[model samples]
Target: MLIWLFLAMNFIITEVVKGIKHLYNEEVAESLISIQDTRKEFEGQATIVVFPIVRFSKKSPEQTANDLGAYLVDNLKEVTAFNVVKGFLNLSIANDYWLDLFNNSLLQPDFGVIPSNGRKVMVEYSSPNTNKPLHLGHVRNNLLGYSVSELLKADGAEVYKVNLVNDRGIHICKSMLAWQKWGNGETPESSGLKGDHLVGKYYVIFDKEYKKEIEALKAEGQTEDEAKKNAPLIKAAQAMLLAWEAGDEAVIDLWKTMNGWVYEGFAISYKNLGVDFDKFYYESNTYLLGKDTVEEGLAKGVFFKKEDGSVWIDLTADGLDQKLVLRADGTSVYITQDLGTAQMKYDDFKMNESIYVVGNEQDYHFKVLFLILDKLGKSWAKGLYHLSYGMVDLPSGKMKSREGTVVDADDLIAEMVATAKQKTEALGKVDHFSEEERETLYYNIGMGALKYFLLKVEPKKRLLFDPAESIDFQGNTGPFIQYTHARIKSLLLKADYTPGVFIDNQVALSETELDMIILLAKYPSEISAAAKTFSPASLANYIYEVAKMFNKFYHEIPPIVKEEDEQLKRLRLSLSDVTAGILKSGMRILGIEVPERM
Candidate 1:
């Protein structure tokens, strides 16, 4: 699906550049591409040339170039007049050329996509465990992963969205153990709690009880470590694990109940957030998948067996410490599963790039994982990327699940929607919308605000999630952009405007309008860069810039008013349509919905 998108984008870019050359009679000197930026070099070919429209330098150079281009329009150095200022040389084509861009940008279905040369990208994220409900941290992960995949798709790459579920392990056992001890046949239906949160509550309860057990063991004259090892909960968990491995009916039955609850909860959250997966993997089924690979490595002399019958890889030669591949009992660990998954995905998709959208704390893990994969002679290991986004911190400091400081995803989203509803009512906006429409609008605005807040910063930077402040609608936010989109919709409705109409060709481009065009033009480059870097924040920031510009343009240039300059009003309204389209497209890149009425 994504492989063709990149090729299409490349084709469109080629055509657009070709159009630019024909319109301006200039030849591009060179084009530069980066993981995060792009530049195009051009040389004026006409004897009498147009002026440079943009200058990257100060007023001195800008003024000089402005004067030079104007004086040479039909005078000296007329054909090759424009000069590069710093790196941004703006070539001023005829007024008709600007009109041409407006028409083309509006008409081209794939206006901003670069042509793809058959690259495949696989993005993995939202690897939630069944032990608890997702929290704000997972929200960040999902948004980042989903948005990056979207951006890659937009950039014309074949993108596969994948996820790994930590369905097995002791952490999951905690929830299962707690449910077995205290559930007392209480189901989500009877408890009136969301399944994941209900299980999470018990998980929390199990810890408190486990702590008391530890205290009791310590009072019996045991060391703290010894007490922990002997705690009843720990012992019970170990016993239950043995039963589970033996396929005991009681343990397996409880596991099914608790895991089912968590799965239902996950489905609800993913549906609400508009996140979907092209593939799903479970650790329970695949955790030991890499055992054969490890054995192969041993046969190939890439790994060695310790005296304890465990397999280990010595990575000090690769600037990493030695690491365990398989335990003495021959159980595969986290990295082992990942190595197998990588190989499986490569064999399945032949992907050129694979992105793991995990937290920054796992930096060391991925570093070792990739190195081992490469050492195992998988050439595609070099393409493995750790899209390590920073943790979501609270104003109070880091969120600790054991301390009960973590915010639940379902609860937070509900709160945001309720807040949006309240704001809508206070503004008397709901009176203008149907009941169902109002509810939908709330969902759109609330989720938009939340997703945008998470995606507005660079991925590597830690995000301070302030529930109160993050929901603010008045400033640089998703709702702010949604409001702009709604405002445009409102005007179009009031004026009865159609989509593809150009009421007046006289654009009369103001600073705001020109700025909007330039910003809009950056959309393709921004999408490609963000896709390359696996950062949705880049697209988020770009949309916010568009909204800011449109706000300025709206207040300074009214589209519908009595006795307004009809020609100017028409141009402004057309520009508003363009701005709205760009906003809609950009917001889509972030997996956000821009409500028509907010």
Candidate 2:
């Protein structure tokens, strides 16, 4: 609001100056105004750069700034004082203005949520394969996707969260084949393992045996390529895939059984992670959908058929090589299915934008997918975006799924919860809590720590995840923010202030109090910036700053309940209450929960 006020003051100043010296139009004057927050050492609320308009005033930057500042203070009641720092015109706003904004902000229920902008956004994340359990990488994907979705919704977009399960293809067949040959009728019930873990075990087994077979063939003097291509295990998996595509009942039944187990496993993990989807897309259902689109492209000269009858799109003009859409056998490739799925999603949601929350490794894949769709003359192709994020590594090294070296999502979550319990107990603060309450508190802290750690980094930057470090109660971590929130809640509870109690504006404010209010005032702007960049990291860090500032204020300022002046005590309590509310709302945007007690 101060920024907008500065803009209005600048406009009025320009209009009045026009009567004296008409050197520039209103548009040019508007462009010349650069308003920003005043630096901490400066005694002002906002500063406007005066150098950009000095030519129009025919004076030195400092002189022009002083002139403009004096004019503003004379005309505007809100402008209390002004200072000229070189080309910067810093204006201190009246305390009543800030108090009024703070009071009004408390009255609005949806304080930070923007009004709906009449746009729909579809986010696709957690595109898992049935051959494996959700791993650490998938954890990042799901968290980022879900957080971005919530972030957009906070900025007033109708968001649709969807998951496209990679439940079919050769990789899935490998798991099925391994189970058929070596499982000996083992099920999740028999092995006491989750369904996805069970399936992932067979997938690893298939890879191990396949590698052994290839080594044997190499020992017989065959080339590596020959061994890999002619391996009996791989051939069997390929045959199983063909059988699956041919609609063989036995293969279908097996596919359904194994995928059912995976689905159940995924559901448990998703629920624990606090992520959800409004719709689910399966590769089995959507794989063949793009063939029609490919055919249409062929007719429209967007694609060409080779001698083997495989359909291809020439993208060299777009700085990429030719891409395969359909094989000679009339089977759709990954991109083919993606093309159809993109169209299908648009038909379903009529969204203005579609974001795919995928890893950076698939950057080229998405580039080709979007280019093909665009060349095919689809009007909505421009809205397709690949939210390409970097991979998350552990301190040990990168995780490999086929070798079973990946950190399982469920296991990591359980470890976080256990770590939370251990740390919370060591703190010795929750001894008075009931067993159930303790359990819930541990869960909230654990999940909150995990989600915040993953989301606090920029989406495009690679990160190293250290579980031990993440659960710490200090630094830029989730538990720290949660603890700050809990501290504020405790203060408010002890003060026994009634909700919606209006504080008199006559009381003098401390520097800390005004600083906290200023930070609180920027919450809506933070949300808008986070939404624009599709980065929850912005909000994550913003909330952390708020929490940190509140903590500092709590330590430096007088105790709320011990204060003698009732009005000052109420004002401090009001600040604590509003800070807690903002922490809760900001954490919610990141899909992290802040507990009332830590």
Candidate 1: segments with Cα more than 4 A from true spot: 1-93, 113-117, 502-507, 558-569
Q: Which stretches of candidate 2 lie over 4 Å from their true place?
A: 1-27
Backbone clashes (count) for model 1: 23
lDDT of each: 0.76, 0.87
Tens-place lDDT digits, model 1, residues 9-89: 233234323433543444442142101111233443111111232222224544544553444444422123455454333
RMSD of 2: 2.3
Clashes of each: 23, 0
- TM-score, candidate 1, is 0.86
Question: Looking at model 2, which ten-residue stretch has the lowest summed lDDT?
Answer: 1-10
Residue 217 in candidate 1, Cα distance off native in Å:
1.5
Q: TM-score for every candidate vs. truth?
A: 0.86, 0.96
Candidate 2, 1-598: lDDT as tens digits: 2353322235444543552243333235454565777888888877887777776777898987777777778877778899999888888878887777677775356667689998899999999999989988999999999999999999999999999998899999999999999999999999999999999999999999999999999999999999999999999999999899899999999999999999999999999999999999998899889988998999999999999999999999888999899999997788989999999999999999999999999999999999999989999999999999999888888887765667889999998899899999999999999999999999988998899999999999998987668777578988999999999888888888776867687877788888888788788888888888999998999899999999999999767799999988888888888889999999998888888887
